[model samples]
Target: PQVVSARFECPSCGNIINVSQDDTSFKQPTKCGCGRKGKFRLIEKKLIDAQKLVIEEAHELLEGGAQPKKINVYLHTDLTSPLTEKRTNPGTKVLITGIIKELPIMTRSGSQSVLYDLSIVGNYIEPIEEDFTELSIEPQELKEILDLSKDPKLYEKLQLSIAPSIFGHERVKEALVLQIFGGVRKKRDDGVITRGDIHILLIGDPGSGKSQLIKRMSVVAPKARFVSGKGVTGAGITATVVRDEFTQGWALEAGALVLANRGYCMIDELDKMNKEDRDAMHEGLEQQSISISKANIQATLRCETTVLSAANPKFGRFDPYMPISDQIDLPVSLINRFDLIFAIKDLPDKERDKVMSRFILKLHQNVDSSKEVPIETGLIRKYVAYAKQKCFPVLTDEAISEIQNYYVKMRSTGVEEESKSVPISARQLEGILRLAEASARIRLAKTVTVEDARKAIDLMQYWLSELAMDKETGKIDIDKIASGITTSERQKIVGVREIIIELENKLGKVIPTDDIIKEAETRGISATKVEDSIEKLKRSGDIFEPKPGFISRL
Candidate 1:
């Protein structure tokens, strides 16, 4: 397969013959003109570039009880290098134009058998789907999209169109719409890059339509992949190195994130994922790339993919009074990476429930449901695609001033109160900028205005109020969401630690747990709160149990 050209010289007449091998296998010239049939003297030979690729059916494409099929493809010459090497990597969907050829099978005795294995000799290879810029839009459709962007209520209309069949998640739907348009990615002169994609997490009760919303988003997004957390592995979500039977060596296989590059990936049942598997997403979310080093293969795969994930609370239902970090099983580090988190509770409100019930019943009874959706699904997709491809808005002076004022005001609250809790961080500020840019993109605006900044701030405030507000302080404490500990809980832990130290100093080395709790009570901490804090400190190795009901500082 590698031989490009071969030279042959006849033994009888010294006539030289030059032949080029173009077929799958080596080809010999039919005639030498002198008619010498014996083995000729081999003089010169040249080899060309060649490679093998394996294509397998994606897991999502498989039906129940069905196994994915795999095929081997052979690539030679120009197709082996340059473009195909990047686009036709493992796990990426590709449309290959090739000629199917049969390879003779060999028996155990090394003799050619009657049976043959089929393989494709690829002539051309291209991705199955292109990016949004490559979308084919008619002139009339382009005009309609531009017109839709000009509508006064375009934002509200798009929000209603998202998951129209699902009722009572206007905020979540609005966030999803912003995520589809996204923002403009920027690379500074110093080489720092800021990602434009938004990540959202939905923690809700069962039967709250989280899955349905995710499915709807995948449909609206130009390129998207749906994956379940329980079914995905660290390697499956990131990248892996596996043995390639065709090449008899390790080959790098791209994962879901890489496959969905420059698109969206929806992960459902997020809480069900193992710790190690969830940790694999850390770099992908923050750095927009996945790095793999295993089996002598090391590489970083691009994964500029937006993530929309859904998870159920630890107890199968959300607890409104509890901090969001405490309700979900995900680590604070991973949770904080998401730009927005919404709790879709299934609380009972008679009037709202009545309205939702009527809406669903009317839809089931074949009433006119089209009135609920302002925009059709096809047009919505095209509009979003056009916006993302064409719009790249920059922040205006008014927008910058608005965002800066909000950040400074929020930071001042924590400082003025002398609260150990952080009201906001640079990460949240970046999220605000990204959201403002997305808002401008929705209007097809070249500059993010004060109005866009205000919209972004309103959404951020809504999320913070729902998920990050401290019940005791009545103030936003970002640490409650970024770290698992609230300010009150942290203070209680500090009090318990001090009580333990005081007792140990007064009553020799080991102190009774009951004495520490009794002392903490005098310091205004309840016995139950003292015990809870003591247990946490012990778990974190700040203190250790010498014996039953006895504690000592570590």
Candidate 2:
């Protein structure tokens, strides 16, 4: 046998045993010098072509069924593809090698293996000395097509793509587009754009098309990722630590947010996440980075990705009788992190019912019903393809003033002392502008006009009105969840409070539960009303328990 190389490793007794392989089948020493031995297998080294190396070879060769290992692939060509190169590029091109190493292993068969997925591991380009040559080809025309300012057909396509996929909720669709190409921006004390990432929250009913809108966004955007809240964990959505092979140490692995940097991440079922996990996301949403210190890995990973999330109310639908603060399962802090929050309520009306029925029937029957909607899916793709490559348009001062006036009046009603001081944040300025730009893009226009801003602001106003209201009172009843039903309850709570105060003052001591109920009835309050007030006061900790029957002020 042609002996190649000898290496020693002891499975037991931790001693080295020499092992070698040749052209023929070989056997290992029966025992180790440490008094334990068996046949040891020899490690082999081989070079394979880049394209020929599949995911199976990576798992079998590198991981060896223990853990996945990272291997380098020496690509013969750069992935930049000269056809897609831009003129005003800032030398930000990353050289990516064509390799399929870190893919998910689905199943394996003899001489065949299946991989779930693959990703591009990109970094600053480094020039290799030997066997490396720059290949030149015609610059790609993709950029020219994406420049909507110069391309009319591209804009036409984008309008059609979103026009059909999103039915009846044109307002939500407009907001989504602004989030995409418009890109959110924040100014620091120094007047620099500090927070440039955009985050949108959709709080709506179960069938308000929030899910459908997000699904459509995943397809239209060039670099977009969609994930469900129930499907992701803190470590999975953000980042985690894994074993490192080169230094024989643990390395931090990038999560979905980090991997989707400079892109869009659509998260569904936002309310189902754990409180701790949701809290962990606050920093990423605002600062666009995840700072985690665990297992000696103290690093801040980049998460400058736009987030589009959807959630249902705590009790399945919006309750107009309750505050927006009390209706959602998520915390106010997390909700405030979103630049814009749209409420989608399912209202039953004749026109809506007829349209919904016709739409569903046509969809299930696989028939083309909206032939004259002026836009097609292919056109939408072309429109987005073009819009991404163009410079963003500016919203004129007239548009800004219009939006400011609308925002100021909606929030200045002073419904409650605990309400938000500013109905709309400065961040919304950017949101509105972007939304207008997208609306213009849908029309395949060169500039965002005042009419576009008006439409966007109208939608924003509707959402703001729904979110900021005293459902118990008669102020801003947009969704009709507030009617004569809540006023009676409010009156009862007030009467119950009065009865408790009167009973306590007269008795000059703790009030017995039965006596308190009787006193409340004398004051024209029902037994049920008195009981509810007791429960509410107990919950609020205004009243405490001496026993189950006796109540005293805390």
Candidate 3:
């Protein structure tokens, strides 16, 4: 075999270096020794004199058994000019048809060389297009896809294919799978489409797979885009000002939402998104369109994209007592935009620990993945494709009734105490239906069953209870924190607050916190409970400390 030397540029670092190769083929690691890896690919190559081929023509030549001897091409075009106002080089996809005349060789003192040179005889440039296909499907077909009870192994396989290397958070994985296949359109009482997409918010601590989950969905979903909230401006998300091609003046360019159109957009570090970006998302979340008149270009861009977003708690970890609005550091407007919010707190548990350990071990070592592969990754794609081609089924009476009851009970039409002020909104109800539909679609069920609705509700409830309900005050709350409270914590705080208030009225003068603690004990409240309640009241500003170790009613 003749030895040939080639340069391998690290995709991450863009460092060009040389490697020796025999004509024999081999698998190479997708990493460079400089601790950079996984986010790069072979971008460009040059060839000469034998033939100049673009990707389409190259494939055609391969089919026709015409193998050119040597080919050289240059990648020198500025890509991403169509999207960004600054004309950033996102990347390029090109096709060429020409003849190669010469080749470049290496003259080295241990130096790397560029491969292949070509003399262009003739060439053709094909327009590069973005893939924007969203899977379509009927309701009956979706139902059949989700009815996986008859084949447990198939269900497991599907999960494996979708999740692949995902570890822990089985609940999150299941929720995401449902969201992918679920239809996001809603028929209102007045017969108009209100909301047509599923909006999910994942609030978690650092390293909780929030970003990983979003990335995974981007790959599994038929059409998806992953963006970072920190990097995305308001114009980057909904629509923004750009220079017009025809008039050579500024115009509005559609953001990821408009570009994604009928697919999914996974946003990472959503809490880090600017306030203006948060404001822009509100309308798109409900109206599914962004209306703007920037640089004299008035337009409403379609943003009918299912949003899967991840955020960190404001305080870094969840504290059960604070209002969610306080804990998350996100505006109520943006928080309410999501149909469902999940708290991915890193709770320490034995089974979870074991699973995590295994997951890490598998990644650190090249263990046998043959037996671990559950479903054909390709099959999952086919299933999603099939569902997209089918029509969506309407909700049955049982499913509708279950959803209606849930909305009526948890969400009040009128405001009550701090505890009751419409826990779930009408938009959330629609989200529930979509999630149920998605679940059914995954199972290949013809129609969404009552069981599917309950499953969705169960998961939603778990999330709401932790993220929305405040255990210290028994109030519906949101916060920048990651963990919530047990019901008992609420009762304890309320009880202690009551005792402190009674002591203030009975004694007339300010009572020391210890005296209030004694009074609480006489009223059957433990010292711990008294302290907990005092802290809650203090946090809420219901009581104040006029002196050290003393309490005053606010």
Best by TM-score: 1
Q: Write the per-residue lDDT of candidate 1 for residues 17-114, one digit (tens) a residue.
A: 99987654566666678876767788888988888887878677899999899778888898977766866654457888999998888788978899
Candidate 3's residue-wise lDDT over 285-360, tens digit each? 7788889876667788777778888998888887755554357777776777776777787767898789888877
> Whole-model lDDT for model 2 versus the true structure?
0.61
Between candidates 1 and 3, name the one with more favorable lDDT: 1
- Deviation (Å) of 287 in candidate 1: 0.5
Each model's TM-score, in the order given? 0.91, 0.63, 0.61
Question: Across residues 1-554, which tens digit of lDDT does each residue of candidate 2 receive?
Answer: 12344665666655655555432234456777777656554444332222111111222245435765434432322324353232101112233444344545434352325544444333323432101013121235344343434554533444455647456776666566667654324456985545544578898998888998888787656556788888788887888887763345777776767756666788999998888777878888877888988888999987777899999999999886667646777776787677677778787789989988887787767656544455544444444545544434556677778777765665564334332233445555655665666666555466667887886777566666667444544354222231212334556666676766877888866888898888777777778777877887888788888888988877
Select the stronger candidate by lDDT from 2 and 3: 3
> Model 3, residue 400: what's the lDDT?
84
What lDDT score goes with residue 125 in model 3?
43
Candidate 3: TM-score?
A: 0.61
Model 1 TM-score (2 dp): 0.91
Q: What's the distance in Å from true for residue 25, model 3?
A: 52
Candidate that beats the other on lDDT, 1 or 2, i.e. the better one:
1
For model 2, the superposed segments whose C-alpha errors exceed 4 Å read 1-160, 163-166, 184-198, 204-208, 317-326, 346-351, 367-389, 415-449, 476-537, 540-543
